[model samples]
Structures are given as C-alpha cells and as structure tokens.
Target: MSDNLQNDNVVIESPEPVDTTLPMVIYALYLASIVTGGLTALVGVVIAYVYRGKGPEWLDQHYRYQVRTFWIGLLYFCLSGVLMFVLIGFVLWLVAVVWLVIRCVKGFKGLQEKRSPENVDTWLV
Candidate 1:
C-alpha cells in the first residue's frame, strides 16, 4: 500500500518541446498581408517577431513568401508610378505568381515529415 501511494505521489514531469508558433503566425499574417496589402503586412511583421522561431515549415515558407510578396508589391507600385505601363504590371504579376507557386511547393515539402529546427521558439504561446 505504501509503495502504491509513493508511486502515485511521484510527479512525472516532462519538459515541453520547443514551440513552433513563430513560424505558424508569420505565415498566417503573411497570407493576410498578401490579401489586404500593407496593413496586413504590418500585423504580420509584428507577429513574425513575436513568434520568432518555431518549428513549422508552413510558417517559414509563409514568412519567406510574404517578404517576397511585400517587396514585389512595392516594386510594382513604384514601377507603375514611374512607367505607367500595363505590360510592366503584367510581368511583375507573373513573377509574383511563380514565387507563390514555388513557396507553396516548399511548404508542402516541409509538411511531409521534413525535420525542422528543434530550438525555434519565438513566442511563449
């Protein structure tokens, strides 16, 4: 009886694995930013910092894509302002589309049992 009680009382504490929240949130906000432009991008930036480094491939891909998207959008806007040509805009659009497809493929690969960094912890939650 005493052994049983002692066994029950023994606390089995295990440390939690490093969180992958940063990557996840960054990717999420990246998408939001793409959809809504700068405002969403701003939010995404904050989230990315907060999340920092999480072990989620989607998050990484999203962050990368979002950054690319943001820059491309800015370039497009600037080029449009300067040249005002529909053809230029179309070319920029094509670039963005290709990047999105590549990012999506990379993200899918990450999801398919790709080992991610273990010590990535951007946010507590």
Candidate 2:
C-alpha cells in the first residue's frame, strides 16, 4: 500500500519542455504599448530581434511576427502623421491601434497553443 501511494505521487515530466516565457513577455509588452505610448513596444521589438532564430523553429515564427508588427506599426504611424494635414490621420491612427491589438492577441493565442502564427507575414491580423 505504501509503494502504491508513492507511485501515485510520482510526477511525470515531458521529455522536452516548451519554453514560452519570452514570447509571452513580448506579447504583454506589445499590449502595454497602447497605454505606454509605444515605449514598451520598442523594448519588445528589440527583445524579439535579439532572440530571433535562437529558438525552436515554431518560436521563430513568433519572433518574426513581432518584429514585423513593430516595423509595420511604425510605418502606419508615420503615414498617419503625414495624413494628419488632411484630417484623415486620426482615423488611420485608430485603425493602427486596432490592428496592433489584434496582432498581439493572435500572437498570444498562438503562444498558448504552442504553435506558430498562421499569418506571420501579413500586415493585417
């Protein structure tokens, strides 16, 4: 009975662990950028760049997606800034915010599932 109890208490671990810490952190930073005025996103992008290609291939997809998100977002913001003179920049800015949020959320979901993003190369979520 004691041996049975001991066996029941034994914990079995996976042969290979999946590490999603950095990806989660990057996703959080991206979401926080909405309130932080893009500073956290800058940090997140830098981390993504530094860590890209250093992990599992599935994880590399996320890093690529994150890096693209930062650059594409910057482009959108710049275009919006230029369009402000015509009064359309405000709307573009709103769209950019929504796009960023969607991308971050999608990335978070993929990370949770331990899978690569489906559309890593797309500009839209």
Candidate 3:
C-alpha cells in the first residue's frame, strides 16, 4: 500500500512545445506590413513587445527577429521617403521591398520547418 501510494504521488513533468501561432502571426504581420507600406508593422511590433517574454527559447528568437525587422524596415522607408527629393528614394524603396520579402520568406520557411532562424539577432538577412 505504501509503495502504491508513493507511485501515485510521483509526478512526471515535461515542458510543452512552443505554440505555433506566434510564428504564423509574425509571418502574417510581415505580409501586412509589406502591403501597407510599413503601416501595420507598428501593430506587429506591439505584439512582439507584449508577448516577448511569454514564449520559450526558440520562439523568443522569432520575436526578436520580427521586432528588429520592423524597426529597421521602418527606418529605411522613412529615409527612402526623404531621399525621394534627391531622386534616390526610388532606389532605396526598391531595396526595402526586396529586404522585406526576403525576411518574410525566410521567417515563414523557418517556421514551416519548425526551426528558428540561423541568426535572428543580426540586422542582415
């Protein structure tokens, strides 16, 4: 009876796998950011900050990567807008578009594979 009681009291605890929704939302936000010309990324940024600490190790990388992408992309766009006066904004804008596409594609692909980006901490892709 004592052995039975001991066995009953023993608990096996295991951590749950990271939720998939965060990465999907991040990916969607990237798409929306591209479509809206960096407008909706602000909302994405907010989500990133709000849930930054709630995720586990792997998911935290996505959050950081997303936050960096939004801010850097926004800064690039703003600079490009001002450079429009010098006939250079067009080129910068094109670069921003390409950068955004690459980031989103890479992020989505990573999530699809159930892996974090190779270097989520870097500004470059």
Q: Highest lDDT, which number?
A: 2
TM-score of 2: 0.85
Over 1-125, each residue of candidate 2 has an lDDT whose tens digit, in order, gives 99999999999886587789998999899889889988999999999999999888989999999999999998998898899999999999899999998998899999999999888988888
Each model's lDDT comes to 0.50, 0.92, 0.81
Candidate RMSDs in Å, in order, are 8.0, 6.0, 2.5
Global lDDT of model 1: 0.50
Q: Write the per-residue lDDT of candidate 1 for residues 1-125, one digit (tens) a residue.
A: 99999998999888555454454455555455446644765775566455534535545644544445445555654565455365676665555545444443444344344443222332110
For residue 97, what is the lDDT in candidate 3? 82
Winner of 2 and 3 under lDDT: 2
Q: Which should have the higher TM-score, number 2 or number 3?
A: 2
**Model 1 segments more than 4 A misplaced:** 1-15, 53-86, 104-125
TM-score of 3: 0.83
Q: Model 1, residue 112: what's the lDDT? A: 45
TM values, all candidates: 0.47, 0.85, 0.83
Model 3 misplaced regions, further than 4 Å: 1-14
Rank by TM-score, descending? 2, 3, 1
List pairs with backbone clashes in candidate 2. none
Give the distance in Å from residue 93's predicted Cα in candidate 3 to where it truly belongs: 0.6
